[model samples]
Target: MEQYAQDTPKWKAELFDWLKSFLIIGSATAVIYLFIMAPYVVQGRSMETTLHDGERVIVNKAIYYLDDPQPGDIVIIHPDASGENWIKRVVAVAGDTVEAKNDQLYVNGQPLQEDYLNENRLKSEAAGVVLTADFGPVTVEEGSVFVMGDNRNNSMDSRVIGPVQLDHVVGRAEFVYWPFNAIRMPK
Candidate 1:
């Protein structure tokens, strides 16, 4: 009768340990990726220069729930209050009157001074309804927001979608994570 001893090769033992560690690390990473660090890719130029289309970003879903959305902060919102996501710049907060005329934007009846826009995009576009000679001094309802794109003429923002309900907001973009060179804090 022959008996086989339990002595194992050092290389085999080391390999087994490495594989176990990798699996643990990989699984933890995936869990965090789906919940905490979900990835998003920009689809339009609505947030151009700040968040370009096709660029990838990381949304901190845990944060907006912790705090309210702030004006001028870029946010990811569900346009229809339905579960789909959309990204747009926050223009006016609740209770503010927003108007656009002669390529200028006025919030609360005061000129909205922005250092972000190099060229205004609201040229010749009617305030509420585009291509109409009429405009608006529309008041954004409480718990709602008026969002617009830096590329005004091209973006279909709050002007087109109407005021966004607060509950529709998904999260604020924390940073851009792709395209290596453009990887940095989103404006």
Candidate 2:
């Protein structure tokens, strides 16, 4: 009877240890999913064709925490005026000269070949020229970025709001995880 009683206590202790281990693992997973690896829902069609409204994308919050934003990367940024977040593609990096003339985009005097843009969505007017037109030869200030939308006609990006400050960039959007077939890395 004494031996049986000792075994019962040992069994209970093992059960408790197993429960604790399971709880710890579950909590860690929740933290990583919510804070690090979760997918964000698209609120607008500014990135249409590339990212659609109501679709979901997985952004790597960990990547931008260490590296600088790169050209051709789609990014999420914060706006001070409206306190809203925006997602757009990085067209011109720091120190690149960006111009839109005759509806063609040029960076550093070299025309950018934007195959991702829809011809119907291209704006005829030079929207970025508002300030650059008045000021002449807009050089993207160091540590700033010029962004645009794939749906060029409809997006309110750096063209309207001016170049985004480097610090305003929140994260690089790495992939779209929702809508099943659209699950792929963003260019």
Q: Candidate 1 clash total?
A: 0
Q: lDDT per model, in order? A: 0.75, 0.75
lDDT of 1 by residue, 118-139 (tens): 5332432334434211247888
Cα error, candidate 1, residue 170 (Å): 0.5
Summarize candidate 2's per-residue lDDT along 1-187 as a digit string, tens digits.
8886677887797898999999999999887774566567877878877888987887766676677787788888775667687889998888888887766788898877777764333443334322112121457888788888777756888878888998788677888888898888876
lDDT of 1 at 73: 80
TM-score of each: 0.73, 0.73
Each prediction's RMSD to truth: 5.5, 5.2
C-alpha-based local distance difference test score of model 1? 0.75
**Candidate 1 deviant stretches above 4 angstroms:** 1-36, 119-134
Pairs of residues clashing in candidate 2? none
**Cα lDDT over the full model 2:** 0.75
